[model samples]
Target: MPDAPAPAPVPLDRSAFAADAVTVAQALIGTTLLVDGVGGVVVETEAYDCEDPASHAFNGPTPRNAPMFGPIGHAYVYRSYGLHWCLNLVCDASQLGSAVLIRAIAPTEGIAIMRDRRGLEALRLLCAGPGRLAQALAVTGAMTGLPLDAPPFRLLPRTEAEPAIAVGPRIGLTRGVATPWRFGLAGSPFLSKPFR
Candidate 1:
């Protein structure tokens, strides 16, 4: 039999990300994140609000965090630990300074490219962290503030049948640890860190 036809790509609009960070974070699970011709299923994310101390916007919008303060459906790529670039999706209304950190994704496209970028053969290790996910998809600071509706970035809508979701506090945070903003696909081995 011929190979199955690929599923139609669904580009999400800005309205889909207009909700609060936490809500958008949970809703992002299982959605397809396409960047630079690479695709993956979002499996882990962490939400940060303007008021959260762990949030980059907690100290107000700096030059590095301008994207997080802009309209929804934009990308917020930032360098974490002065090293690898991490990808975040701007959420909430304009000036809300809310975003969801995309921590992990299950590689579904461009596996060979991702393997070369990550230097790892294990499927689950391909995009198992914020930095790794960005690197695997070739995301950089240059892509920050770009609208998701355009090329180099497109978020496919989630399926109607909800996957089992696991929620807990955000990771590696010194403050706002009580906020259960982290969301992941339950039992997914692709998770970056163990769910608390």
Candidate 2:
């Protein structure tokens, strides 16, 4: 007999994101991030809380960071260095100002769309970093505060075995340089440069 096909990834409920930043960051590994028909398996993430100086929520809520202070299970898209968009998943309770930055993902669907948007041929490069993944997935600041369970965006649960995860200090941060809160799927080639 032939092998059975795998089931589709399950869409996560709001309860799934009701945890603290570090817990949500590690838990996000292997989950699928969806934008329209395009999606990728999350491979790397970094946690941030209001207490962290490197966090956008560090000092408290601002007009630019209203989403971080709004609801859980919402998207917190933001511009970085005036160069690229970064995607973060809102976490913890309301007004808590916590989130998990999705740093990298392995492309799984809409390869053509992602490739065209990225203008890159290598599959691994399509969504290898936060900015690249946001670009490839067509995320923008307009999508900020949108519920992750709604149109043009969704989060699917990790259906496979618990991935082997690695932990280390987050990359590209000056204030929280020694904070070891970054999490990534071990052995995944589609990862951003590590903080070595």
**lDDT scores for all predictions?**
0.90, 0.91
RMSD of each: 2.3, 1.9
Tens digits of per-residue lDDT, candidate 1, 1-196, equal 9999988866888888988888899999999998987969999999998998999999998999999888889999999988999999998994489999999998999999999998989998999999889889999999999998889887888874688999998887889988888999998999998785
Distance from true location, Cα of 115 in model 2, Å: 0.8
* Clash totals in order: 0, 0
Predicted candidate 2 versus true structure: per-residue lDDT over 1-196, tens digit per residue: 9989987666897788899999999999999888997978999999999999999999998999999999899999999999999999999994399999999999999999999999989998898889999999998999999998888887888877788899999998889988999999988989986434
- List candidate 2 stretches off by more than 4 Å: 1-8, 194-196
Q: Cα deviation of 164 in candidate 2 (Å)?
A: 0.7
- After TM-score superposition, the amount by which residue 26's alpha carbon in candidate 2 deviates from its true location, in angstroms, is 0.5
Q: How high a TM-score does candidate 2 get?
A: 0.94
Cα shift from native, residue 7, model 2 (Å): 5.5
